[model samples]
Target: MVHNFNSGPSVLPKEVFEEASRAVLDFNGTGLSILEIGHRTSLFQAVIDEAIQTTRELMKLDSDHEVLFLHGGASTQFFQIPMNLLAEGSTAAYLDCGTWGKKAIKEAKLYGNVEVVASSKDRNYTYIPKGYNIPSNATYFHYTTNNTIEGTQMHSIPETSVPLVADMSSDILSYEMDFNRFALIYAGAQKNMGAAGVNLVVVKKDILGKAGRPLPTMMDYREHIANGSLLNTPPVFAIYVAMLTLRWLKQQGGVSVIEKINDRKAQLLYDTLDSLPVFHPTVAKEDRSKMNVVWVMDDPDLEKEFLAICKDNGMVGIKGHRSVGGFRASLYNALPLESVELLTSLMKEFALKKLNRICLRLFLSRHCGLLLSLPAR
Candidate 1:
């Protein structure tokens, strides 16, 4: 069996895949394929409603928080968030964890006074930046929950009366979160949810209509929420697939249970990496990510060789990001521990051989030294 560990558009539950496979051909009570169904049809409306309801249920959100599924990607929200929330004079305090956080900070700067409260760039983003003072009057504190490229994560949120907004594109639904504390939480539905066409935006109702700016119809969170996220045609298939994934998550004892399993998987991989003398984990221990584990061998060349061996052994998507080159094994919710076990076994074997070779070379060097230094008797 094969395991897919790609960071984005990553592994999905097999049960979700099986159900989605059938829905592609024939949807509920309708002969038309799910892809062919009219977005306005009652059948599709039910699908949309169930998805929104399930999302609310999963997050345990209140009436204050309304979930909206939109067509623009999460990157779109990089701008829309500031446009819809912050005004010309207001500032948003941002924490730069990695690539996505930097992008969010960059985009928000175009709309308002963006204060970079803290950043991990000085340290190569190996650890999450914490303890920076957020301006009490700041519009909100924006952060990315997990850094897929750098393999760093914010394990717990900073306490703030000021609103907290997160770009959870890579970590959403993989674990539990305090929905009440967030003013906004948005994720692109490709990684843990479904396909790439749709972005899920969940916003607290109290946070809207405060920006007081004229937002474009497509860019307005209020507009989408007002129209039930159906102002225009939506990515019907993507939402449907996401709904199936959510259903599967529910069946597997919900996020609380899945989190336990995810913790176990991450521990297994990290422990194996630490135990192998040749492998060095890149992410800092305190800020290590559960989703992405980045590491390298004593020799960069050997790391490349190890990746090639993994690919030949039926593993895919283990290569690290180009900017942070080495090895990154993404253990999204669907990646089984068996795949991790296989990778660990290979690492152990390779490390043993390396140690043996070192031992043999040292023995020869000492023997040569004795022969050269010995006096004629």
Candidate 2:
């Protein structure tokens, strides 16, 4: 069986896929495909409603928050958030942890002053910045909870009084945390939530309409919330699939149960990496991501050969990003522990093979030298 380790558009539960495939053909005995269902009809409405409600329940959000399924992925929120929250004169505090956070900082600058509270760019973002002070007067303190490309994660929320905003695209629902602590949380559905084409935004109701700037109807969070995330034709099929995944998450006993499984999977892989001398982990131990574990070969020349072995063994998307040439194994919520176990086993086998080859070469070299010294025998 193929093992999927892709970072985005990543693995989902097998049951979710089965249910989604059936809906594409015939939905709920309605004799109509989910793809063709009218978004405003009761049928699609129930799908969106459950999707939102499940999200709220999983996160244990209160009535003060609103969940929205929007059109653009998390990337769009980089700019849209500032448009709705950052005003002409106010400043927003940002923590630049990695690529996504940098992009967010760039976008926030367009709307208002952006004060970078801390950044780990000096070291290629291999670690999360700590002990930085958030500006008290800033409109909101924005941070990316998990850095997918860099394989770094913030294990705990920063203590701050300013409103908190987080881009949890890669790690949402993978662990349990105080979901209500953030004034706003956004995630692209493809990573841990569901298929592509839908973005999940959870915002506190009070945070809206305070930016003091007139936003275009489509750019306004209030408008989307007001319309129940149906300001326009929603991504019908994507939302349906997301609903299925969320339901699956609930049936599996919510985030608390899944978090433990995710932890075990991550720990097993990390332990393997730590024990192998040939492999080198990229991120700091404290900052290593539970979702994305990145590492490179100590001898870079062996990377291609290792990747080849992984491919031959049915591993997919084990290659890292182009910016960082290495391996990145994405352990998403739906990824079973068996996949990680297989990967770790492969890694151990590869290391042993290399060591055996080295020993054979040394043995041959020593014996050949002795034979040459014997000369005319």
Among all candidates shown, the one with the greatest lDDT: 2
Collision count for each candidate, in order: 0, 0
How close to the true structure is residue 303 of candidate 2, measured as C-alpha lDDT? 92
> lDDT of candidate 2?
0.93
For model 1, give the 10-residue run with minimal summed lDDT: 368-377
Model 1, runs deviating above 4 Å: 367-377
Superposition error at 50 for model 2 (Å): 0.7
Candidate 2's TM-score: 0.97
Write candidate 2's Cα lDDT for 1-377 as tens digits. Answer: 99999999999999999998999899999999998989999999999999999999999999999999999999999999999999899999999999999999999999999999999999999999998999899999999999999999999988989999999999999999999999999999998999999999999989889889888999999989889999999999989889999999999999999999999999999999999888999999999999999999866669988999899999999999887779999999999899999999999998888877766666766887632222110
Q: Model 2 — which ten-residue stretch has the worst lDDT? A: 368-377
CA lDDT, every model vs. true structure: 0.87, 0.93
22 Cα displacement, candidate 2 (Å): 0.6
Q: Which model scores highest in TM-score?
A: 2
Residue 285 error for model 2, in Å?
A: 0.4
